[model samples]
Target: MTPKKEQMTMKQMMSRRAVVRVPSGPASIETIDVPVVEPGPGELRVKIGAAAINPVDLGVAGGLFHQLALVDQPDYTGLGWDFAGTVEATGPGVELPGGTRVAGFIDGFDRDHGSHAEHLLVPAANVAVVPDGLDLVEAATVPLNATAAAQLVDLLGAPPNDARRLLVTGAAGAVGAYVAALAKDRSWQVTGMARAADEQFVRGLGVDFTTDLGQAWDAVADAGALQEDAFRAVREGGRFIGMQPAARLPEERGIAVEVVFARPDGALLARLLARVATGELPARVHAVAPLDEVACAYQAMAQGSIRGRIVLVP
Candidate 1:
């Protein structure tokens, strides 16, 4: 007779490991062993191969989102939101088999475990299959930035029949670049503000107009110091997609301002992943290092002016 399958005891189920850092600050980053996690029902435990670092990682490390209760008081917090990996295990009620490759974002600020670790527990609904022929390391950059950019596009609603003009500030930034690409595909007359040096790069994304931020300031405000000259470039009744919630801009001229705050939406993420797979989007990987070298990665991110994402390989 065939032997019955043995159930995983609590100890056996917890053998997977991860890295922990006290306070999660760039200056305080330290690697420590963490209990292997088992996915709950409808979840999958992914063996992460690559993770992406964003500016928000810096903020979280610095204790900026403490009020969100994401940091652990007695133990260290894990730090990462974007990841790409293969599923090694699944919880009860999940049908995905082991070895299926996928990618997704976790709410790093609110979860005990994050994407930077060796193994991560993620909701089955949150992940999308990596498109055929796309590298998992490159696919790691998509979730967070793509979700945010897609949210911004949705918030702006559809472009009018006349093809309303839109200006994307920080167009060369990760989220900004994604937003520009998506908006361009949606038939918006997209104008992007980028460094003078990035004009050609921005244009490569099919931006109809590319101008230095300095020249566009007068388009929106004659005297407001917080507004970039790019605001003036939009048609008075058109739209502006700002990258941050606090993106200060003049309220005059009836120009609508929509701030992008990206959240995990599986349907939206799936759509964005399709674009990435087809080369309609760019992942823009600037640097890659082992997960243990996260401190160096954070340091490089803090230095600023790096155009693409810094990825961590586990």
Candidate 2:
């Protein structure tokens, strides 16, 4: 039988998941059977179509977050953050019916289950309907990165004056590209710092492109996780926002340092997904692999410098 048929034939009492018990690294990843949990009140059970592999998932699989004491699951740690799927069942007080296409993410590292599975139980308020134009594979890449960018820009706020020069490192990256596009609404003159080859893509977002990280910007959105390096580019008393919540940079030289911890906001995601559907935002997918090939996909992502996300289909 094909994987899809096999999935349908599996008993409804159990689900398949990618997990790590010791988290030694990608090599330690294991696919195992887990109980199929029913949704509680105000919750929904999603039959996952696609889940995106992210740096955070790598951290979970490699024991980085475990070393930091962020994960405390006794048996195993779940992998994956963002996913796009169809609602299979809804609990009491939920309005979405079965078979509705949706995309969303679950935040935090201390969990026994995640989106990289045959099924997921998520809060109804944490997901938004997948729009008409966007496919599940591409939609899976949006929730975590785009939400983080929106939250990071929220911390940056509006520039104090008209001379609002802002530098965004990793402009070609998932989060950085969203930041570059969204920051313009706050009246900031956004300059994306990326490789010379990324000039066209960065400029396509209606932001200036720079191959170098020049100094003395009014604010610096460090989506690249440059930490100290990106912090130094900010002018005195300027704002410095970072995506790394685990390794937050200390404030210095009158620069305000803040970090974004992406949280699920279904309503906010609806707006962002609409932009993607309209081509106002980009949905980048590097590759798609079956759920059984998760370990290989994680290995490929670990090699570094991948431009787009690798999505896993179940």
What TM-score would each prediction reach against the true structure?
Answer: 0.82, 0.96
Tell me the deviation in Å of residue 276 in model 2: 0.3
Scanning candidate 1 in windows of ten residues, the lowest lDDT window is 216-225
Relative to the unseen true structure, what is the Cα RMSD of model 2? 3.1
* Candidate 1 residue 190 C-alpha distance from true site, Å: 0.4
Name the best candidate (by lDDT).
2
Tens-digit per-residue lDDT, 55-103, candidate 2: 9999999999888989999999999999999999999999998999999
Q: What is each predicted model's overall lDDT from 0 to 1?
A: 0.73, 0.92
Which clashing pairs does model 2 show?
Answer: none
When summed lDDT is taken over every stretch of 10 residues in candidate 2, the lowest stretch is 241-250
Residue 148, candidate 1: C-alpha displacement in angstroms: 0.9
